[model samples]
Target: MKIYTKKGDSGETSLFGGTRVPKSNERIEAYGTVDELNSFIGLAASYELSESGTKYLRKVQELLFTLGADLATPPSSQTRIDRISADDVSFLEDAIDTLEENLESLKNFVLPGGSQPGATLHIARTICRRAERATVKCANVDDISDNCIKFLNRLSDFLFVIARYENKHAGVREETWKGKQ
Candidate 1:
């Protein structure tokens, strides 16, 4: 099959429900950002990490495809939609808790740096935040599932916690942000 559908050359794209929207549609942005975040997660996962870290990130990447599907399908459509669930959000929270067990509590604001892998995870975290904001904006105009938003929120925290875990895993020191002199 040809990768280029050429149908989108008219500045429009089709959703899962076979409905067409502009390429600039908020829903497109929402799911596109999630797709972008998924790529970054893959990049971070490519780095050296613990077995559990690899497993968790792989899980997250898989779930993100579901999230992208959820965003791509409109509620009005009769298509069978993939919806985010409370369990998804809870998984992120549980992962955070598990990773935080070995991490020091924050005394000051943390800077996004440590080892190369940690920085990569920080980039993924920021992308996750942007995806969340895009999803929220999509919610304003469409019937986006609240669970999807909640999942994005928790995913960012999960990324943050994992980044910290990566730093500590590398025996790298976290640079706490100090006041600008």
Candidate 2:
């Protein structure tokens, strides 16, 4: 299939149900940011210190693709394939719980830096927040699944924990935010 169909040349694109909307549509913005976050997650995964970290990141990337599919469909015409179910959010929560089990309790805010993978995970986490915010904005005008937003929220938290985990495993000390201490 040709990559350029010239269909979106007029600044409009089709949703999953063949409904066309402007490229600047909120749905597009939300899914686009999700795509961006997925890329950053891939980059972060490339530098992960543990096999489990890479595995989790790959799963998150897959979930982002699912979210993009969900956002790409008009609610009026959406089907099961376009639905990001609560099970998706539960998956993220489970992953978060597992990762948190291996992490130390947070005593204070952490400075975002340490090993290269840790820093990249921090960047990915911030991008995940942006994606989540964009999704929330889309939800204001559309029938977005609450699970989608919940998954993103938990995924960001998972990224933060994975960053600290990577740092700890790599023998990199986490820099705590000490307000002038």
Candidate 3:
């Protein structure tokens, strides 16, 4: 299929099942943020990462596509797509639990800078938050899956933990936020 369909020239796009809506539609905004998150994750993966980190990130990237599709396809649509589910959230939680086991317990807010990969992960975490908020807003009016919100929430936590793990593996010390004296 050609990339330039010119179908959206009028600022309208089609959902999965041929439902046309404005590009500024809430569902579009939510999945657009998700697509942005996926791009950042791809950038993070381009850096040097541990074997497990690389593996998990690859999986997360795949799931984000599913999430985007889920958000794009409303429940009323006939398109059957894989969607965010409880199991997906659990996967993130499990990964976070495993990675956090090697890190020191958190006693204060952690700063968002480290090695390149670690810093990129921190950036991705913030984008994840924005994506989650957009998804929440979309859910308020659309039939978005509850798991979509849950997955984004847990994914942010996963990104934070994985950032620390990446820094630890790279021998970079995590800087904690210190309030003004």
Candidate 4:
């Protein structure tokens, strides 16, 4: 199949159910941001410090792809195939819990840099938030599952914990914002 469909040249694109909307539609923006987050997750995964981290990141990447598919489909015609399961969100929660068990409890705001991999994870976390926001906006107009938003919210938390875990593993000290102290 040719990569260029030539159908979108007129500034419109088709949703999963064959519904055509403008290329600038909110649904397009929502899924596009999810796709962007997936790429950042791939970059972060490339620099993971441990086998477990790599595996978890791979799972997160797959979930983000599922989210992208969910967002790309028209809500009225969306199917089970496009929905992300609760299990996917629970997996992220489990990983976050496992990583947090080893880290010191947070008492202050964190500066978002550390080892190279940690910094990349932080970048991915921010992108995840943007994707979530975009998805929320789309949901306001379309029929999006609450679980979808919940998954994105938890995924951002998971990325933050993973970044801290990576920094701790790398012996990189987290620079706390001491403010006027």
Best lDDT among the predictions, by candidate number: 3
Model 4: worst 10 consecutive residues (lDDT sum): 73-82
Q: Sort by lDDT, best first: what order?
A: 3, 1, 4, 2
Could you give candidate 1's per-residue lDDT for residues 70-129 as a string of tens digits? Answer: 999887779997788899999999999999999999998899988877899999999999
lDDT of 2 by residue, 1-181 (tens): 8889999999999988788899999999999999999998888877746887878888778888888988887666745574677887788778878878888898899999899989999999999999899999999988776677888888888889889988888889989987985
Best by TM-score: 3
lDDT of candidate 3 at residue 155, scale 0 to 100: 97
User: Where does model 1 exceed 4 Å of error?
Assistant: none
* Every model's TM-score: 0.97, 0.94, 0.98, 0.94
Cα lDDT of model 4 by residue, 15-113, tens digit: 887889998998899888888888887887777487778888888888888888888765567444657879888988889999999999999989999
| Candidate 1 similarity to native, TM-score | 0.97
Roughly what TM-score does model 4 have, to 2 decimal places? 0.94
Provide C-alpha RMSD values for all models, in order. Answer: 1.0, 1.4, 0.7, 1.4
What total of clashing residue pairs does each candidate reach?
A: 0, 0, 0, 0
Q: What residue runs in model 4 are displaced by over 4 Å at the alpha carbon? A: 78-82
Question: In candidate 2, how many Å is residue 2 off?
Answer: 1.4
lDDT of each: 0.92, 0.85, 0.94, 0.86
Over 4 Å off, model 3: none
